[model samples]
Target: MDPILDDHLHLDPVKGRGVEAAEEFADHGGTHLLVLNKPSWHYDVAVEAGDDFRVAYDHTLDVVADSTEVLPGRAWPVLGVHPALVSQLVERGYDPEDARDLMCAGLDVAAEYVEEGRALALKSGRPHYDVSEAVWAASNEVMRHAFALGADLGCAVQLHAEGSEDFTEVADWAEEAGMARERVVKHYSTGGVVGPTPSVLADKDELERVVERDVPFMMETDFIDDPDRPGAVLGPKTVPRRTRWLREEGYDEALERAHVETPRLVYGIDTLGTLA
Candidate 1:
């Protein structure tokens, strides 16, 4: 496969399970993987791997230090705050204003290159604004903050926004917020709400829109389909099918080609090991 560069790769852990899976992938011509540094499991793996892979911290500042010390010249620390965390704060009785500020600060601390808008258990069935209003608000604030920082932080916020309707609203709101149109990138599923099929995205012209606008769109292989091993939530059988479909829709091929051709394109794996 010509040493394909996977933008996202998630590792599963059972003692030495996850990192071993990553090592196997590396051995098999995988160029780099983006590891989401979240949960106790991932933290343990990142601290262990050092620079062997790229790390994206879910909600921590210490990763900045690790990236500085380990990866140095690269954008070592990548950050993403869990929307669920915001939900947690709300549940804990924190004032909305205080909670929003704290979430904004977390985004600032890690210089998060991406944002994951996945559902928190409590916020899942509730109204979008009520369930994740604080998250959405904080996300908007961080967008402004990133612009004010005057650094092209090269961060791409990944919203698990479900479908086209919410996506349009989010994109429209971000545009109104003056977020650089070129910088805004949508995460997985481009149509119908939540995990839309590739056919849905391409059939509706969403992919063309993203390409024409040059938004850094990416899809993740979130630990469900493990190539090295099976039994994941979504592994090779699932993720690669989507990747092939996206390629058919004219998405760039691999991270290396994308880096050279469409530098804005990014990839990640939402699992234990880092993507180099």
Candidate 2:
């Protein structure tokens, strides 16, 4: 069987089940996972200026690196600042302006990690639709900065915005930031949204449409690693199961493109580097 890669997932101790989750994913045929850092309280404080953020960023790298002990070459790291946390900070009494500043600073740290080979990509994007326009705008600004930074560092930027059928706005943002549309990935991408930009889809029917369009995409459970909600968005084993289903349905070519080829092209993962 060809190895299945999960493009987006969290494996942190705070909100995720960490190493145990990694073991479970591996047990279920998940070969490689792009472990993203969530905007937990420690991370929020770590994004602040000074040596604190740097230390936090380094710790993030350490945590991701440690996942390899449980899954070997299957673990890869994606570091970034989540934009939704801006609203959380505002609710906690932090000034909006200060929150924006911290977000930008966090992106800078994430870009540095990409440059240092500590991570393969950076994740940042707008919050949900219900957030205040001011918060949304501030998050967009941060995303712009992140796009620019990713462009400069030759890294892909995964966007965590609301699900939208049209990605023209995000493509425009990438263009305005002088970044390549191909380097901009839409995270938590569902069947509803379709485009050329790389994305990770959860639904098989939607995955079929994306493949039919010849879109560059991958599969993800967006597994948050929450023990209480275990497999909240989708189970850790979901992608692998979907891959098997596609194979059975005779969509071998599509599965190969989405599960094997696209990840290698976007994240530069050699087949030999994946877990056996």
Candidate 3:
């Protein structure tokens, strides 16, 4: 069987089971994973500045190194500053411009990791709701900077944005940033948007829409690995199990498109090989 690729997950040590979660995913038939950096608090980037940004950036690289030790070729790292963290900084007395600068600096660090092949992609986007307009606009600037950096580094940028039926704004931002729309993955997608491929959660109903559209996209459990919430979005085993279910139900074409072809096309990852 071709390996199932999970496009979005978190291997946070403090809130999550970390390597244990990866092992569980493997046991369930998942072979490739894109693990995003843990939230900003893990490195205190929102509350501090200067060297703190470097420390926070380094922490994500450390996660990539450690996750590789556990999952080897199967685990790939995605580094970036989430928009929620940007909002947090703004609320904590950070000027919006400074916050944007901090996010850009973090993206620069992530770009280095990508250049070195220590990471596979960059993540940046604003939340769907709860952020002030000013904060959202500022966060968009941060995301634009990330898009440019990703373009320069030849890496894909996975976006975390508000749930919406239309993604015209995201596509516009990508264009304005001089990045290709194909390189921007809309994470946590509900399978509603038409343009700019998305990485959506595992849901049979949503999968129906995705298959109907025949769009380029991928599936993710968005597994947070939180011990307290324990599979808050979905369990580590969810994607593999869903892939099995889809295959059994004769959705082989859709399964292969999302689990294999699209990921390789978008992220330039070949999960069949071992990581160096």
Worst 10 residues of 2 by lDDT: 42-51
Candidate scoring better on lDDT of 1 and 2: 2
What does candidate 3's lDDT look like per residue over 1-276, in tens digits? 476888998887554687778888877877778888877676444446434455555655666566667663567888877778777777778888888888777777778878898789898887667877777778888888888887788789998888886887778778777777877898988877655678878987887778788888799999877676877798988988888888888888988788777877888777665533
Give lDDT tens digits, candidate 1, residues 1-276.
Answer: 422323333443333244454444444433333344343323343122223112334322332233223321211222444444445556667765665566555445444233322211000011134455655665455444433331234343434333344444554444455544333434344433322111122222444444454433433344422344464433422333444455676665432233233223222322213323
Which wins on TM-score, candidate 2 or candidate 3? 3
Which stretches in model 3 have alpha-carbon errors above 4 Å?
43-47, 54-59, 69-73, 273-276
Query: Which residues of candidate 2, in runs, are more than 4 Å off?
Result: 42-47, 50-59, 195-198, 272-276
Compute the lDDT for candidate 1.
Answer: 0.37
Q: Which pairs of residues clash in candidate 2, taking residues 3 or more apart in a chain or in different chains? A: none
Q: Which candidate leads in TM-score?
A: 3
Question: How do the candidates rank by lDDT, highest first?
Answer: 3, 2, 1
Clashes per candidate (backbone, < 3 Å): 26, 0, 1
lDDT, candidates in the order shown: 0.37, 0.74, 0.78
The sequence of per-residue lDDT tens digits that candidate 2 reaches over residues 183-214 is 77788876546442556666777777776776
Q: Is candidate 1 or candidate 3 better by TM-score?
A: 3
Clashing pairs in 3: 128-162
